[model samples]
Target: MPAEGVELTPSPQILTKTEILRLANLFLSSGVTKIRLTGGEPTVRKDIEDICLELSNLKGLRTLSMTTNGIALTRKLPRLKDCGLTSLNISVDTLVPAKFEFMTKRRGHEKVMNSINAAIDLGFNPVKVNCVVMRGFNDDGICDFVELTRDKPIDIRFIEFMPFDGNVWNVKKLVPYSEMLDTVMKQFPSLKRDQDHPTDTAKNFTIDGHEGRVSFITSMTEHFCAGCNRLRLLADGNFKVCLFGPSELAVSMAEYGSGSCLLLD
Candidate 1:
């Protein structure tokens, strides 16, 4: 979240539940098996459970996951799981409460922690915690987050800070994956390589005797563009082929009224 805050798109311009399903079904029919409900914060939507329930039931959709800030996730996770949410990725840049509040411009550290615990309790396999490591920001907390995986079965994903829209993007602030891995190795010399999926962006590892695992998303230093198989559909119905790439197509389901005419034929 930017300090001045982001401009909220008008509600009427945002895609409704039906429109989201239409686009999702189209993608599923086109052989897209995994679907993750990312955001701004997927938990904020009033009809999120309804959306999750319907999307989980869609044929050919193998995964129904969500990436949330975890503010309202604690109470919602049980229902969300019962509604068929298969996976979860919670973003917590800092383990320090003050730093968390400063980074997000909000006071929800306890809530976020509770959400993480709740997800683990609910048995969400590979409960991934996303931590974007910035040099001067939360890079020092890498081991702190890694320690989270000491006993729990959580997967701590330390993501390299990358350039994106809004906020200042400086090379000095970027913490490359190599540096992060070295930092971890210094602490846990017993760190051993773990197998990763062919298309996985994160280079995974596990420490001897630790029940959990850690992975580094080296988006900055080592680009995974070739193996990258991800597309982003914005809340306002804009289609982004890549997170760092330009918008390739724009469709306003609000204007088209969930009609197939707006879809690619």
Candidate 2:
């Protein structure tokens, strides 16, 4: 995950098309199938379309997705789709503007909603809306988020808030998996879990006769560290094994001789 509150570097030292292509080629050759671009906010990067295009063209690559705050997706979804973006996971905490601004420290709730609509309009399948549920922060909007996507094809996932970024994470602030299910079940009495694609972090549920689905990501109450398959490469080239894992390996293009590795046992 991108570190929040870091000073933005205003230089033109961003990754070039050729460098991105090289990195994509290396990962594809290493038997990696899916690639996701994430950051403090990836959409803010200049010329992101070019980077997407290069990755989409890589051989043997099965999936190309992105995780964004959705602040800039509305204006770039079409172009991004053309460049082979298959799916999107947008981070939207609350439907209420005041709470959203307070959580993200930015005013982009309206823009995020527009981006979700734009992504759907662009034919992105299963557009996912990621909502981090904190007990007293935005838990009140869980039902609202679920209702918002009931008629659409989007998937709204309610992620249990975890301790990170040195924030004062109170265990009581976590909306437990049981409570989340209870909330949705009350609204849709016929809601059932989807066992087709089992993901440990999120308990997937779908409403009867609805096109969308809702999920509860109980990361703290339930961990899926064993089956986790992801390696985060920081913008400056640090390798992060797990989101909550402490072990990390920092390398450069020169030291490692041009390849990323899984350092975790």
TM-score of each: 0.92, 0.88
Over the stretch 113-143, how does candidate 2's per-residue lDDT look in tens digits?
Answer: 9998898888876889999888888888888
What value does the lDDT take at residue 207 in candidate 1?
96
Q: What is the clash count of model 1? A: 0
Best by lDDT: 1
Show where candidate 1 strays beyond 4 Å: 251-265
Per-candidate clashes, comma-separated: 0, 1
- Model 2 pairs whose backbones collide: 135-173
The superposed Cα distance between candidate 1 and the true structure at residue 189, in angstroms, equals: 1.2
Per-residue alpha-carbon lDDT of model 1 for 5-45, expressed as tens digits? 88998999898999889988877766678888887888889
Q: Worst 10-residue stretch by lDDT in candidate 1?
A: 256-265
